[model samples]
Target: MHDFPDIDYTQRFIFDESDVRGELVALERSYAEVLAKHPYPEPVAQLLGEMLAAAALLVGTLKFDGLLVLQARSLGPVSLLMVECSSEREIRGIARYDESLITPDATLQELMPDGDLTMTIDPRQGKRYQGIVGLDGVDLSACLSSYFVMSEQLPTRFWIKADGKRARGLLLQQLPAARLTDPEEREASWQHVNTLVDTLTAEELLSLNNETVLHRLFHEDAVRMFDIQPLVFRCSCSRERSANALVSLGLEDAQQLVIEHNGTVEIDCQFCNQRYLFDATDVAQLFAGGGVDTPSDTRH
Candidate 1:
C-alpha cells in the first residue's frame, strides 16, 4: 500500500557517517498552483512541474540564501521554461510552448527540441552566477543532475516524477570535499543508497509521503531526517516594483517604450499571469519623479 499524505512535503536527510546527503520533495497543491495560471501543453506542464520539484529539492540542499532558478531556453516550439525557488521554499514558474496540439505521451524533446538548460543562483548580497549546459538528456531531472556535476563539481543523481496530480523528486549528492584519501567508503555508500532509490517509480514518488519514501529508499541504513519545510507558490510581482522599473528606465526610454507598445506598456507576470498595465500618464508620472502610484487591481 502507498503511504500518502494530505499535505506536500520537502525534507532533508543525512547519513550518520558518510559525507552524503539527500532531499525528498513531494508536491501536489504547489504544483497545481503553477499549472493553473496558463494553458500549457501537456508536455510543457509536465516539464514545468518536474522543474519546480527539482528546484525545491535543490533549495533544500544548497547553502545559499537567495533565489535559484532552472531555465530551459530553446529555439523550438517551446521557447522558454523556468522555475524560480527561493531558499525559503517559495516557488513560481511558467512555460512558453508554441505548439497548439500536445499529446499526453509527449516527451521533453517533443516540447523543447533544441534547447539549453541553465541554472542561475542569485544571492541576496553577492554576485549572481549562472551555468549553462546542453540539454542532452530526455528529462528535466537528468539535465539538473548534469548541471550539478558540471557546476558544483559534485557527483549527483536525481529521480523526478510528475503527473496531473503533482510532481516529486529525490536528490543525492556525494560531497566533493570528501574524496581526498578515503574515497571508497563514501562512493560505496552513495552507490548503495542510490541503488535502492533506482527502484522508485513515478507513482511511488508522487503518492508516497516523505518519511515513507525515505524509508523505502534507505530503510536499512542510518538516515537522519530533518524537519519538513512547507513549500508554497508565490509570485513576487507588484505594481510598486513594476512602477519602480519604469522609473529606472528614465523618461525618454519610458516614452519610447510606451509608444512602441501602443501607448500602454503592459508587463505580465509569467508565474501568476497578472498583468500590470502602464499607460502614457502612468509612464509620465513614473518619470515625473512622483511616488509610484498604486495600480487598480484587476483580476480575470
Candidate 2:
C-alpha cells in the first residue's frame, strides 16, 4: 500500500458483499502546480484546488474517452472558474475573481451568485455531451454531486478539501447495474461507512496518509483497495500551439496585433503564466511558411 510514488493516487474499493463503490484521491504536486501559477487569494486558491482534486476523483471513477470539464459561469466579478481533466489524467485549471469581492468568509454563492454549474464531456471521436444545472450547492464538491445525481442518476457523494500545498477528495458511487435490487445490509454498510467518513475532518484528510485514512473510515468492513495510479502536474500549452492560434486568427489580425503591441503579439498561458511572443520576423516567417515553428523563450 505504501510503495507507490506520492504524486496523486485514485483507488477503487469495494465492500466485498456490497454493491457500493468508492474512490479516494490524494494529490500533492498536481494541486500545488495549479496554484503556483498565480498568487490567488486564500479562499480562491483553496476553492480552485478543491475543484481540481474533485475533477481528478470524478474522472478516475468514470469511464470516458476524452476530456471532462467542470465549469461555473457567473455574472459577478468572478465570472468563471474551470477545471479540466483529460481521460489520460492530465489536469489544469484557472480561476477568475474580483479583487474587491475578496473577503475572509466569502462563499461560492458570493463568488458566483447567479451561475450554472456544468459538466461537459467531449470524446475524441464522438459528439460532445454536456449536463447543465444551477449552482445548488455551497461548494464545488456538493455542486458536482448534484450533477452526479442528475446526469448519472446514482447515489453519489463527494468529500473534497484543499490548501496551497495539497488537495484531496473521496468519491462514493452506487454502481448502476448493481442498484437494481435493494439490499438493506448493503445500504446499512454504506451508511455506516458514511458516518465514519463523515468524522474525517478536513485537517485529518489533508494531513494523514491514504492508507491510514481508509483504515480509519472502513476498518470494520472488508474493503478491498486496488492499485495506485500516478497523478502528475502538466500543462498542454506550447509555443507551436500558440503560434497556430495566432495563425488561425488570420495574418491580418496577427499583424495588427503585433503592430498594436509594438512589434510583438504576446500571448500568456493562464495556467502557467508563461508568455509567448511573436515579433515581425516571426510573423513574416509564419505567413511565408504554411506552418509556424515554436518560438524559443529566453526568460527563465
lDDT of 2: 0.79
Candidate 1 residue 296 Cα shift, in angstroms, is: 6.9
Cα TM-score per model: 0.89, 0.89
- Tens-place lDDT per residue, model 2, 111-194, is 788789788888887889888878768887778778877876778889999877778888887664453366776577667777
Spell out the clash pairs found in candidate 1: none
C-alpha lDDT of candidate 1 relative to the true structure? 0.81
Candidate 1 residues 1-300, lDDT tens each?
556566667888887767788888888888888888987767777788888888898887778999999898987767888889998888999888776646678787776776898889999989998889887787877887787778766788899988866888899987654532466776677788888988998887877787877888788878898888888888888877778888888889988998999978888876797888887877776676665554434521
Q: How close is candidate 2 to the true structure, as a TM-score?
A: 0.89
Off by over 4 Å in 2: 1-5, 177-180, 183-189, 294-300
lDDT for 120 (candidate 2): 84
| Candidate 1: residue 119 lDDT (0-100) | 83
